[model samples]
Target: MMKILIIEDEPSVRVGLSFTLESKGHKITTAENGLDGIRIFEREGFDIVISDLRLPGADGIEVLKSIKNISPDTGVIIMTAFADVKNAVEAMREGAYDYISKPFEPDELLIVIDRFIKHKGLELENIRLKEEIRERERFQHIIGTSPAMQRIFETIEVIAKTDSSVIIYGESGTGKELVANALHNLSPRKDKPFIKINCAAIPETLLESELFGHEKGAFTGAVQRRKGKFEAASGGTIFLDEIGDMPLALQAKLLRVLESHTFERLGGNESLTIDVRVIYATRKNLKDEVKANRFREDLFYRLNVLPITLPPLRDRKEDIPLLVNHFLKMFGEKLEKSDLAVTPGTMDMFMEYDYPGNVRELKHSVEMAATLCKGTKIERWCLPAEIRGDGETPDAVISVFDDLPLTERVKTFEREAIRRVLEETHGKKKEAAKKLGISRETLWRKLKEHGFPVSPSDLEE
Candidate 1:
């Protein structure tokens, strides 16, 4: 049963509405005035609020504004006997879910309440579904079945429930922004705005106003009051990407907002309060920054309430094939090349190189291969020179020396090159075979003959 609040100054009307709503199997709470109703509404949780338009002390509009300020998700219906179209339009403009006329049929009021309640239910369900989709997308984007990534997933699940500040730390190109998006999408504020500000991208002089808004004539270009990311993200989440690059002066202001959830517009004394969840991501070491006095220690503590570290792609090489396949499908669809397929030899070539640029580099490589491949299959020649060692064909094994006796040299340089490729590719025999210009079966036989490990799992570890 949904909880409904009835706020009307008239004793008879309030009691009648309460009785009718209670009869409909809803738990009802009655208030004699708008002030009392707002207090109860703030102190207690209700699914929907029904407030009379005219009330003593605080008016219905004020109550509706307060309700929206506290919880935008709550459904508010304004009741008015004045019957002024202007008042109804104003109430709707101020975010009232709906307006009800006084002296209305009990069934009419019930229908309005039922419809709004159903809408609220659907809204909540949609938010939940969106969050699930975001989580799935985040997982799909970061292909890693390693223990490190699994732990990160578990941490994301636990922290997404609260509006606490989050700090994500990782190496460059480690997908910190992706993690930030995951946090915002999984949070309760998922349905609301999810604003991202790249602190490093914007100029330091403008970053303050960009975050806390500014009043008209606040600066040279300030002609009218402008809402910043924080205000725009009211009742939602704001992702501060590359926050470690934020100016020291702005960091203090950010700390103030985090401490009180209140901030004044630039060049304005009026302080505005917003309910915004902050998620910060950065590649810089905040602790080192703090020690060097570049980053505020207090602000660091505030943002680092729940810290998450993303493992580098190199650290989880086992995920390379999964990432490759994912990127292949993604870029193929994006480029309209659905028939694009990487030869086993070409894939092996990929395993040989250490992707210093991480997942981003891998994605670019896949897109390039898909674009450059003229034939149905992407060949070794399609891959970059760094990936394809010595630019040899897959089936051709390098001959170290034709003049040297077999007994004089125990190992051929060709065998050494193949072993090096296997090591680089993390032992995925198919990837190794591609790198060595050999078939998967040949690579497997060669590995068995040479006592070299040849599984994706072995390579990953």
Candidate 2:
């Protein structure tokens, strides 16, 4: 376990971070101010020191200097507000490990910590975390390790370099916008502006003006001649979210712009050409919409160059623990419970219950539990009524781990989780391991350790 020190003035934020890290099996210590944080570091060394940029006593930079003076190898992470980002970046020049913005998700910070830990263990010569930071700038929020998600990541990496128009398909709350951001950030237009417009949210009467811009006196609200999203995103990226909701006339206009690379503002004959990369996202199936004559067939074909489908949370049950940990830390910070934990039974309910709203539902569930629970551990009762109301979770699941040692309890939970996945795959060990985000060899060892037969045929029952 890594020893982590949190130095922040806010009690809720400090406790929330402390709880999140502690839940990850790390030893965590907190100081209310930077001066005390430096003194604590002088007495007790730590693997990482996460300090807020501003403090009552010595500031984060001072603490960083003292920590580096004491132990150069120790990683120092600066926590800064949006305004102090420049100072945080400068700290990297002075031997700080990394910097995270205030109110950042717990999982995001964990990714940086994990990256540092991996390098520290390998004793890498260069400790500059800029590359990883760059990688996450657009892609950091996505959380998943299932095979389906892995394939999506690979596809994004390959297609992001090209200026291909991407069509992302996913159920609501499946992170379609995040994928769009990844494509834009990872592409040549990384330095360019990225503008997003939701087609469904705007009225049909104004959708054209919003996308292609409008001239003064073009419509009732046209007070002044203004640029549209495409014009504003010149030589950049324009994400047309909910494009499926675009009317047929506007769809034809969008198609013309795609084919001819030019468009005219509403009530204007003058044509404007733009060099903007286009990305579209939708929760609806365009093919079906086209068949129904709701979406234009030509527009559908134009936008479907490179399609990316995000799997729902239920399909990747193995990633629930990671997602839960992320949400726990986030809500814990807001709720001021740094020692938060979910009971094994409650976790089982979480894993078993299918999230119809996908990751968004799971995130909200964690938030609700964190808000209601008075103690560090979240119990089954703390869960939202809808989850508990389903009443499908087995009492036996909780009873099995009762009074067991911590390690034994964890092992039992792992075995059950693996068994469920194996059953889902119909005894296909390869598929099961991929779903579990583990190597086939590791799965084989786990099967044997859990008193399961090695033969795939044995799992068929």
Task: Per model, state how many residue pairs clash.
Answer: 7, 1
Stretches off by above 4 angstroms in model 2 are 1-138, 392-461
TM-score of each: 0.55, 0.57
Model 1 bad stretches (over 4 Å): 1-140, 389-461
* lDDT tens digits, residue span 49-69, model 2: 999988889998989999999
- Please report the candidate that would top lDDT against the real structure: 2
Model 2's alpha-carbon lDDT is: 0.85
lDDT for position 215 in model 1: 96
